[model samples]
Target: PRLREELKKNYWIVDNGYNSFPTQIPGEGGEMLCDDEIGDNIIGVLFAAQDTTATVMTWVVKYLHDEPKLLECVKV
Candidate 1:
């Protein structure tokens, strides 16, 4: 919620009242995200999660490095 204005574009609203990225449901005939919109949002979310994922992985490696037995078990 506190992301700087410059970084705000990194996140996207799937659909709001404006429906800037409008799409439609195939059979139901309702507004929804199309393939491109889905892909765009997914990419945004994944990129945003990168730092968090890397931090967790770094912690995991640090823990395993401190515990040889645990690391060996994980390798198997």
Candidate 2:
């Protein structure tokens, strides 16, 4: 319900005369997306973002450990 309201109130839709789609911002004359599709897309984006961040952080920590001088500088 809240998501639906948000979609309805989206700035692009309300201010720019853009049509709302279920999962994405469709181009002109595109069809609206369903709620489920939007939800799935949101979930996928969240997971992908989280995984990327985690992987980057893991590499950073590994590199920092390998370079004690850099790690000490960062600690300060």
Candidate 3:
């Protein structure tokens, strides 16, 4: 607890507890902001965004390749 005490002595860290999101670490008084549990939540959000974007891009490219006439029209 010496490190914690030392850090707190120099810096004033407070847990606001406004956000209920899950954090990487449990409890407060560490390096995390407000001791929020954000490990799983952030990972899920990032994965979802990445997967959806890839799916859309893949479909768009496949559609464009299949319909060369449609692609040419868009260029003009």
lDDT of 1 by residue, 1-76 (tens): 2333322333343223231332232212333457566546545645677754464455457768999998898799
lDDT of 2 by residue, 16-73 (tens): 5342333444433454566466546545655777754454455557768999997897
Clashing pairs in model 3, backbone N/Cα/C closer than 3 A? 22-37, 22-38, 23-37, 23-38, 23-39
User: Which stretches of candidate 2 lie above 4 Å from their native place?
Assistant: 1-48
Q: Model 3, range 1-76, lDDT digits (tens) per residue?
A: 7656644543432234222222223235555434124424344455788754454455446666899986796589
lDDT, each prediction: 0.49, 0.56, 0.48
Q: Over the full model, what C-alpha lDDT does candidate 1 score relative to the true structure?
A: 0.49
Top lDDT prediction, candidate number:
2
RMSD of each: 14.0, 15.0, 16.4
Candidate that beats the other on TM-score, 1 or 3, i.e. the better one? 1
Runs of candidate 3 with Cα error greater than 4 angstroms are: 1-48
In angstroms, give how far residue 4 of model 3 lies from its true place. Answer: 60
Q: List the residue pairs that clash in candidate 2.
A: 22-33
